[model samples]
Target: MYEMNVEDRGKLTSNRTFLVKNITKTMNVVDKLMEDGTITDDLKQDIEAKLTDNDKNRKLLDIIPRRGPKAFKAFLNALVKTDNAFSAEQLSPGAGAIYKVSMTSSEKGMVSPEEEKPQNQHSEIILPKKWPTEQDFVKDFIVKTCSHSEKGKLQSDNYYKMRSKPRGRVLMFNNFVAVAHKVEEEDGLWKEKLQMRDGTEKDEQSLRRLFEQLHFDVEVKKDRKVEQMRSDIAEEKAHRFHKDADCFILVFLSHGSTEGIYGTDGNVLTTDEVKSSLNNKNFGSMTNKPKLIFIQACCADTYDKGANVADNMAKDMSDARKSMSALNLNDPKLENVDEADSKVEKSPSDADMFIANATTQDNVSFRNTKFGSWFIQALVYIFRNYACQTDLLDMLTLVNKLVSEGRASDRDRNIAVAVSVFESTLRHKLHFFP
Candidate 1:
């Protein structure tokens, strides 16, 4: 039936330009599919129902740029809206159904085929009171994904329960390794400056308070060399190795770079080197456990307010893909070169590591004399309020919300947190016991 419809449609359109336009229109639907992350059996069926022929399908497939926020959104939209309203098999035991009413300007008509008429009986459509900015878009996207997930509540619970790990211990490392030295090496030059700014203490104090609230064993190390700090971490890891630890938390309050951390002696050591040293055979005894590392430091120098788009990494990937395409490279070479360029670290220390940088990739990690880094302050603040009762991501989302919608310098203090749990598949209620 699809083939016959395509054949008839093709006969009616002899104009190549019109055929090309038709093909482009069809491809737009495919692009939507790729955007929304919904490439499934039902997705294919819905798409097939929209297009009439193989030629149109081929044309549509060619226009998709491989990756983008739009494409990803389209992919996901296809997944939930196609077939039986929502995929029943994809829902978890306790999951409820999601029915989203996406509205378009009737005055302008629908922009895409995936956009269906709003089922709301009201004739006049009321636009959303506020247009969603990038941050709003990200939070909404995450919320939608979670709502659709099978183990949604449990996953959410595990994130919220930061201090409830029965098998793993939570260790909080507070205290910025102060930086004190007189310009490299000056013969007996003692510059006793307050290296860890007042801001640093606020973050440290808050972290300490959070743990104190949770009744977890907290360790505070101030004014330590690289080796000494590493040794302390090692000892703690070893102590917790045989003992039942629920989780391991390491918060570094100091000056940092993309490579590693800065010590009080003005010496820099790679975070990777420090973390690697804490592996199972080394200082880290809690192998395959959830390890969280929050680094309140700088990553890049570009702090353009306008550049705060959806996903910087995804944008970079898209740019790289375009660059590769423009180079006119062959299939094999493209695959190899692209693969090498896009390579990422698989695992960090066999422990679930969460690295939350103080700022975004190209933004500055702010420092206030009283509040510390905006990212850290926001993190601790949100965790203090919600960590025990809500999901970790939810808490982080709140942090993001607070930061994004906050003041001038503070707003720019964008944070980027990445986490990897060691697959325990368990949930806990994270709360301050005290």
Candidate 2:
């Protein structure tokens, strides 16, 4: 019946104005999809590769009267209006339906074979106030998916019950390791004094390769200033596709002070700024998802010169991640002041996010000019080797071990790097795909 209708429609004249209207509406749909991150950059590039074939297919498909893009728009419009427990053809008979709606628009002059001047019902048409954002879509999905899923038992009495795993994205980007060394004064008059970082390229390469293997869409930004860094990170969090990711990773590599990390221009940007930029509340779709941030830089310039140092070999804290649970803030305790501090970490008590600092507050984290930052080296190694078998916190602790005692026998200079969880909803153990 569908084919016969198509055959009959093929006999009709292809009206130029009607084709333009349909194409215009279709473009609107595609633009909205791209904004929602349903059609990603990578997905767009893939489709563009076969542009000629795609265009031809699009033109041919558009030949079918009252179908294609117009039909899709009408379907979404119906979803917006009704609260019906929607279902489509079962994906494979017994398998559950993948909520699809196939309906034709009631717009007049739909280039039909009948040549009937159909009465218009354009006045009754109701469009959505705003297109559903990707985050909006997923939160809705989570509510629906969880409603249908088999409920699982909670892990511990202290741990809150989670019927559904919080959804999120694995967002990774380098704020661009900037030049931190001092340059000679304008006309070579005064010698500028400073510490320097080298071989960060090693860190970048290792990260790009590692995430590629792990199947994350990674983007690297270099030479980002303070305001610029803040904007970009915020934009990423606000991106339409961000809500779909279950995990987020932010790796910071630059010179930092006891207060916070610095941008390429040597201006300090507080971790509080970072917190705001990456706040989970900003993304309704990612409210309970895990956001992992790894920062590697000197917390300060106070390098120890071996005076009041201990007379023993530095002990690598091999059991760091095990003790990590004793950190971070979030959904469980943030809003409830009475249970705060005691139930979770202090201050910025958001949820489902981890902040890893290379050095503790008010201390310097040593870096090697020859290899790379000690912290990043250990992080890449542990992630590449241990992520499959180890829990995330444990993996970070293992990284702390290698970085703290694992540095050259130069001096007992700095303390261990730390990873803090903020608003953590990590109710269960997670592992990277082997």
lDDT of 2 by residue, 1-434 (tens): 12324433442233222222222233333334455444445544444444454463254334323443333333233222222111110001111122222222332112122112121111221222211111111101001111111222234333222223323334443444453434577787644333334656556655654554444556767767778877878777777765556566777777776666667666767776676556555645556555677777655654433332564424432221221100011112235445534864433346666677766555566544544555665666556544443456777776666554422222342323432222234544544432
Q: What is the lDDT of residue 401 in candidate 1?
A: 56
Instruction: Summing lDDT over every window of 10 consecutive residues in candidate 2, give the lowest-scoring window.
Output: 139-148
**Residue 144's C-alpha lDDT in candidate 2?**
15
lDDT of 1 by residue, 1-434 (tens): 01223332333233233223222234344544645453444545555565566555544333222333244234324323332111211222111123234522331121222123222111221222211112121101101121223223444644433334332444544445465323533776556443544557656655654454343555667766678777777677667343456566776666554455566765555666655555533544555455666666544333434434566433332211110000000000001122455567433333344445555543444455544445665665455433334455455655655544322322323332221111112234332322
Those runs of model 2 whose alpha carbons end farther than 4 Å from true positions after fitting are 1-196, 304-349, 409-425
Error of 1 at 400 (Å): 2.9
lDDT of the candidates, in the order given: 0.41, 0.44
TM-score (C-alpha, index-matched) for candidate 1: 0.45
CA-only RMSD, every prediction: 24.5, 19.1
